[model samples]
Target: MTPFQTLTGTAAPLLEKGKLMSNVDTDMIIPKQFLKTTTRTGLSKGLFHELKTRADGSENPDFVLNKPAYAKAGILIAGENFGCGSSREHAPWALLDQGITCVIAPSFADIFHNNCYKNGILPVRLPMDVCEQLAALAGGANHVFTVDLATQTLTTPDGVTHAFDVDPGRKSNLMAGLDEIGASLKVAGEISEFEHKRRLMTPWLEPAI
Candidate 1:
């Protein structure tokens, strides 16, 4: 995980106007066929595979992601209840692999939200109306947006600002590029000291050398 301080890039609307595609599960984000790989490589090709393809595996130009302007979009302004299904870390992995560093939505699945932070993706949660406005703005010209995690704010290309909040511990971990294990290891000295004291107090619990 790399420390995520700020991301400034093109913001693309994940859906059209008034078409709120809620409850977008991990399976839909990346189908079961794509879950065979344990590695992050090659997952991007499967992103929204079902939605972005036709019955005969043809490219669906109608899909928002298939559009030329959004092809390389790094920030996704999405609807509510996004990522609402199974807890698959691969969802964020695929997004990150596809160069999406941030996701702005009204709501997200709990596990998916946590996975985003672990994988160096910033998941911004804003009010539904705010998200709708951002989505609308993203659809028009001026789609570029900036997300400053340090400031906990989202800045639209037109200078509009929206405040957001994240867990302080998560924020610290993200800034330092530390995952759960990395965070725990940050106090390794204390852990080692405690273990040493425990061994001295309970010598019989120690294995024979």
Candidate 2:
């Protein structure tokens, strides 16, 4: 996972018929068909598969992501309860593959919120009104937005800054680019020492190879 400190890029608003769609679940972000792969590579092709694809398997030009201007958006402005439903890590994987690193919404599923941090994605929670304002700004000609994890602030295209809160540990891990595995490796020396002592103290607990 890449370290996240400050990100400056265009924001894509995930809207349906000019209105923000609520309860944007994981299946909507990346359908179950795309969850076959354990690795994160090539998942971008399946990101928002349903929304971006038409009934005849053609591209849905009306979708926000399919729009040329938002094709490479690095941030997403979404509605409440985003990333709901199943707890699939692939959701963030697909988003990251699609070059999206930050998602702003009024709220998010607990599991999905934690998964975002583990994958180096910043999921910001703000008031619904604030998110709507941000989405409107993102749809404008000047759609660039800046998110500073170190400062816990999001700067809109119009120069207004909004503050948000995040867990200290998660914030630290993101800033250091430390995923769960990476974080555990940081204490490898201590783990090895403890294992060595455990073997001597209770050899019977060891499994037979």
The candidate maximizing lDDT is 2
| lDDT (10s digit) by residue, model 2, range 1-209 | 89999999999999988878899999999999998999998999999898999999999999888999999999999999999999999999999999999999999999999999999999999999999899999999999999999999999988999999999988999999999899899999999999999999999999999
User: What lDDT is obtained when candidate 1 is compared to the true structure?
Assistant: 0.88
Every model's TM-score: 0.94, 0.93
- Model 1 Cα lDDT, one tens digit per residue, 1-209: 88999988888777744565667889998888888889987899999898889999899998878898888899988888888889988899999888898998889999999899889998999988898889888888778899999999999988999999999999999999999999999999999999999999999999999
Specify the poorest-scoring 10-residue window by lDDT in model 2. 13-22
- Give lDDT: candidate 2, residue 113: 96
Which RMSD values do the candidates have, in order?
Answer: 1.6, 1.7
Task: List residue ranges in candidate 1 displaced over 4 A.
Answer: 204-209
- Model 2 Cα displacement at 2 (Å)? 1.0
Give me the overall lDDT of model 2.
0.95
